[model samples]
Target: MDKTTEEKFVTLLEENQNIVHKICRLYTNNRDQHNDLFQEITIQLWRAFPKFRGDSKFSTWMYRVGLNTAITLYRKSKRTVQTQDFDAVMFRISSEEYDDTVEQQLKLMYSAVKELNDIDKALVFLYLEDKNYSEISETLGITEVNARVKMNRVKKKLKKILNP
Candidate 1:
């Protein structure tokens, strides 16, 4: 990449890297896998950067590419275990003051999200990020109506998991 393109990519990526992190966190089971997936997504984004038209918000385009790369690259594995490392430094919560109830609830929610299939997880991720139905449809290449329906179903599934 030229210096100009490199600079642009870095600026855009720095501003929106949280989107990639969220996808990585939702898709990967452990820190190692998350880092690997994050690298892969970054590479894919760089390769596709030149083709990015200015039609949509950069974050929207980032979500589309990041989610696609994650779903394609990370869904081949069939791991059933969900492992999360909740270090105090990572979560900004002091170890001595950690709340067991909050930790347990967080673990339960993460487990429930981990149980969702690849596409549903993407939908949920976008939904949680406050992406609208149209943007979700555009990112996932589904109809806006379908996005709404699928989001409703994902919410119900999450509720069931939490309640059960």
Candidate 2:
């Protein structure tokens, strides 16, 4: 709450904001929704900053808070039964750099990812971010073994969705 703490929070948020953006991208279907989720996550993080005891890495803590915020929003939105098309260009891959085949594959993969349940989506997001099983378990409050099991299930699920 003090100036020093506020400064530290700003610095940390600036350094790790990509983590927040990635989570938002996975959870929201539009630019407006993405910005709303990002702002809400920032508010949640700021509110919880005072209680952050540093028991885990700052980035790890950010992941926990960010994912929880996203999941909560996702559940609330689902209760309203609103459905939107997946943004196929979410990754903004340039066609100049990659061939149409690769771009199409990425789009299909992202579309499949969007179809996953909230927890499964979080698992895939964390996996893509290169988080180890321990970190994924810690972030999602599951055992490492459970994380592995869920991730395997999620992968197969994505495969089925993409192929079917």
Candidate 3:
């Protein structure tokens, strides 16, 4: 990659790193796996950076590439031997205070989400991020109608997990 493209890629990644991190957290059960998936997604983004045509926002492109990496290209065998507690790696309470009830509910929701299949998890991620059906369809390579249907199913499943 040329210096210009490299610089541009770095800038864009810095701004949208949270998207990659969220994907990493959603897909991996442990911290080692999260780090591994994050690294793999970064490498894939860098390699595919040259092909980015700017047709969409950089964040949107990053989402598609990051999801593709996490869902398809990442290998579980590469995870490190060291295991970390899922809560320790997945959730952090900053200095700002939060409600205990809300925190517990959020944890339960995260647990339910983690149990979903890969594609369902991806759909949930996109839906939670407020992506419209069209954007979700484009990101996941599914029809808009399919995206809507899948999202409805995911919501129903989550409701069952939470309420049952």
In order, candidate lDDTs are 0.77, 0.79, 0.75
Tens digits of lDDT, candidate 2, 1-164 = 68788778878887888888778777776657776777778777887999999999999999999999888878887622233333431222111221234335466677789999989999998999899999999999999999999999998998899788
Off by over 4 Å in 1: 79-105
- Which residue pairs clash within candidate 1? none
Instruction: Tell me which residue pairs clash in candidate 2.
Output: none
Which is better, 1 or 2, measured by lDDT?
A: 2
Error of 1 at 28 (Å): 0.7
| Residue 122 Cα positional deviation in candidate 3, in Å, after optimal superposition | 0.6
TM-score of each: 0.81, 0.83, 0.80
**Top-scoring candidate (lDDT):** 2
Q: Scored by Cα lDDT, where does model 2 land?
A: 0.79
Better structure of 2 and 3 per lDDT: 2
Q: Per-residue error at 70 for model 3, in Å?
A: 0.8
Question: What is the clash count of model 1?
Answer: 0
Rate residue 131 of model 2 by lDDT. 94
Ordered list by lDDT, greatest first: 2, 1, 3
Write down the RMSD of all candidates, one decimal each: 7.6, 7.9, 7.2
